[model samples]
Target: MTTRHPNAGLERLHRETGWTLRQLAQEINRLGTERGTPVAYQKPSVHQWLNGQLPKESVRPLIIEAFSRKLLRPVTYGEAGFPEPAEESKNPPATVEGLMELGRQDMDPSRRSVLGAGLFSVALTVPGWQDVVGRMEAIKQNPKLRIGQAEVRAVLAMTERLSDLDDDFGGRYARPMAAAFLVNTVSPYLKAESSSETRNSMLSAAAFLCYLTGWMAVDEGAHGRAQQYYVRALELAGASGDHNTYCHVLRGMSVQAANLGHGAPAVRLANAAAEAAPESTPRMRAFMAGQQAHAYALAGERTNARTALREAERAVNQAESQLGTFGGFSSATLAYSTAEVRYALGDTLGSIQSLQDHFRLRDSTDMQRSKLIFSSLLAERQLQVGHLEEACATWNSVLDEYPAIHSGRIDEQMAKIASLLSSYQRNPIARQTSERSRELCLK
Candidate 1:
């Protein structure tokens, strides 16, 4: 008979959690449901896992995530007595090859669900600028294929068009197209022969596209997949020695963390972005500082958050009008960031006021998707403050535009509309809005 010893690492973590076997099993099962791969794990499964019984491959991540959430820290596989995943154990692939694989997976409809199932890890190891700078794998360039400034320009133009699509419509439809482009066109261009300047420009363009794709993924709530794309963006940006794009990608990651309410990681990433910025213009300073303020607020650093917000305001004041600034940090954007910071700090009424200011500053150039999202947020806050009639009016406007936009974040907001207004159904406007929300959800 084989002697099966207990898993000491798992045992230690379990003890630290102070959870009974049943509680641990329940938490894992809950997380599984959240990931859309529901499992009926019970106490027996937990006991077996603790007693040297290896779990099925898919269940391992759920276990780790459950521990991470409960402990409020990253719990690695090693700490949970699991072997490192095969992909992690292997030598990392070349940037181009890796990007192709990721993009291809994203492009395939059947594979997208699996990709979305990837769990967001608080402990994801992000590469430093020094580590990745100029570190792209040597391409075995085909002498027959040469790209120049024109090709780089084409990539940039295509990315701009995609951004427009993402803005008007939403990421759910736009992301697949972006992924296909990355795999089909961008990957080959990366591997093609070009002058050093042309090559670096192409690299920077590709990095921006990757960042946009990741931003779309975040819109669709595929956070883990988004993080993967963001990392690739960072690697490409660093390889091109594009300090601006590198910092921009870091700020995007901070936004992702903040949206998911992972405050510590958000603060860390936002601060990293600000710290790594190179010769930043005033607009860029506002962009970085605005995100820093949001992140610091989320992390409960009131003093730091206030200081960052003031710096962002100062930078915005100093910035001159420029076309095509990265992420467009304008007065409107600042107002939105202020709202976010206020909300994070429990200033609900102040947040609503800031959001109103955001709309007042908005112009025709603002994204339709963003308009709906901010409107929905404004309505939610209005409802929280007992302005039921005002909230209903705002939601009606959101519903009017909702059918045209396909975004996971927007869908989430729509889902909340019914629940939030359920208690106020006695009010006629709330009743109508709730019914309309349900109809949209059904569609």
Candidate 2:
């Protein structure tokens, strides 16, 4: 029933290993077991691969190892008939290659390699910042490809547009296009020769894209892929000596950790980000401190949460007074932090008030995802306080935006709201709203 094509590359590699198909399969299976994922890949499976069948992405790493051990040399995934992963290194060219590979894989929605390898190791999140930072390389005087200011400017422009799209439409709409641009356009520039200035600019641009890609991955519910992107982005940021972007990437990691309920680790990452930020920007300081506040709240450290919240507010006020530039540290940023702090302290009314302030301060043209999230939280809080009519009303606001955006986080929120409303199914308003929420989820 299967069409077979000659996989000459794989057949050639197997021949070089001096092992028959059976022996190779045995070695692969052993490696898989050692890695705690037992696989029974047999000789037939090896034959099938040689006949052009691709194994699961997770199995590719094990196969690479099997070839490495048998061949007595470092075997890349490509050498073992698998696609290359996003590679990282102190070397800029190598890092670019990794980013390109990531982009290439992401461009194909059907490819499960990156998405399926969702290995979120909370253990690996710690213990690399110092080494990574220390190993940051200086901009190369001579790059492989000749790059110029024009190319760099183009990449930056694309990044800005993609960022805006991400804010408005969520990651699902823009992530594939971003991935394509990174690989098809940006990677070539990174691979080309360039002057030191051009190289630094290019590295910074690539780093920004990587960070955005990771954030998009988070929105896609692919936490493992997001972690990989964050780590590589941090490396690129450090190598470019871009402290501001470096701190931002760290803050992203902290946010992801907090979302995963590893509150202590999240707080630690946020603290590190705050420590690493440029002193000239109070807005950055406030954002990092606010992240720490949110992490503390997640950890149920009421005192620490309040303390960090106060610090965040003070820094935000200072930033505003001094006219510091804003990125993610806009007015909505502070209000969101305040809401988290208040909710942690059991001040439901205060939390609601802060959330309303967030809505008032956030630009209407900004990301609809944020609006959906804030509205969902507001409705949940209102429902909790026995304000049934207001809760239903608040949820209706979310429905207004729900059909327009595609976000895993938003979908999860809608599902939660639907589940909560089930208890109120006897009420006509609750039943109607619950049905609408379910319809959105199905879509």
Candidate 3:
């Protein structure tokens, strides 16, 4: 996804650091071995990375990981000449699952083997990906408009599209297209201007990307990497001077932290999000408060958690009232976020009821698959309370759709369903459901 010449800074940095690609790779190998996460690097592959040439997209993260470990401080993508968001909102709708798809594809060592995998967003509404590439080429032709804020915004919008929509109606086609526009076209924009506003907006964009990447790490059970990303994202959000975006990133961090059982920081982070973004649009406010409730629930502060949930509900109601006549997410996404908290807090009934309310507000098919995960999680809570027959039935009902939706979030939910059914795998109905889930869902 890097757009600058593959060796954007390779030639400069490799010499300055006095480390050959092979030397760095060896250091990486040694570091990983010492840490007990040994990685084998091909010498030729190391040479290719040094000279850029894209260095195989699969090796991008390895390079990042190796450098981050060596630096002993955070090494943001922007600093590495990797494409960073220069303009756009940080929280793309499919941000959670999209990054995992990125990492999954990156697992392959072969360049072509790493197919287009991480794509979602409404940004695909743009013209063809080739059109975008052409546009980037044209930017090179124009001296005045090349780095203009308008062009930067255009690129940011395209990135958003790649992370939102999941219509099997060719979503894979959109991934590389958007990545191309960002890397080849937009990344140069980051270097165009270091003006205060541009810098702030770029930071906001970078933070959002971090949030997406962190969310992906969470799906893979990589807790420490996920936490580090969240912390850096939070800092970037602060640097951007945007309370709304910062809160959103923090809200995401709360979910990750809570899922990893870091109850206290989770609670604190979500609470700060809610507090700082108090004047945010009603939907945004609900998202923050919902995050607060989730963190409190994980912390076992039932009384406080319940109160925050009520506040979240109040925020949702206020949001709906304001957008009473309209059907658009800019107003309704907060309630969907709130529903997720309901499930997180063990409110299965509430989650189901809220989701039912949300079923009609969508303009994208991506939410259809998302709704299934919410339903599955609700069933999980049902099983927790001894509603085995209903839970088995509920999990089975959605099994029909599981195989087709490859989002990693669905993977986690399916794994949970599988675990829940394990207790009753011997039962006839349970056996059928477990096999269906395993056979259909575990890719």
What is the C-alpha local distance difference test score of each model? Answer: 0.91, 0.77, 0.55
Candidate 3 lDDT tens digits, 1-443: 32334665655545555676678878656644433356787677666654555554444545555565444334455555555534332753232233333334434324422232221110112112122111211112233533445654764575466555443312233333433443444444544545666655765675565555455445444445455456555655555565555567667766766765556667866776666663556666566666677778767787777787777677667775544322122324545555656666667677665665565564564455556766676577677767788778778767767666645556668876667677797788888888887877645
Error in Å for residue 346 of model 3: 6.4
Top candidate on TM-score is 1
Question: Which regions in candidate 2 have their CA more than 4 angstroms from the true location?
Answer: 1-93, 112-117, 126-130, 133-144, 321-328
> Ten consecutive residues with minimal summed lDDT in candidate 3?
119-128
Question: Can you rank all candidates by TM-score, best first?
Answer: 1, 2, 3
Off by over 4 Å in 3: 1-146, 165-186, 194-203, 220-223, 227-232, 235-239, 278-281, 320-366, 416-419, 423-427, 441-443
How would you order the candidates by lDDT, starting with the best? 1, 2, 3
Per-model TM-score, in order, reads 0.95, 0.75, 0.57
Residue 232's lDDT in candidate 2: 79
The best candidate by lDDT is 1
**Candidate 1: residue 244 Cα off by (Å):** 0.5
TM-score of 2: 0.75
As for model 2, its CA RMSD to the true structure in angstroms is 10.8
Model 2 clashing-pair count: 7
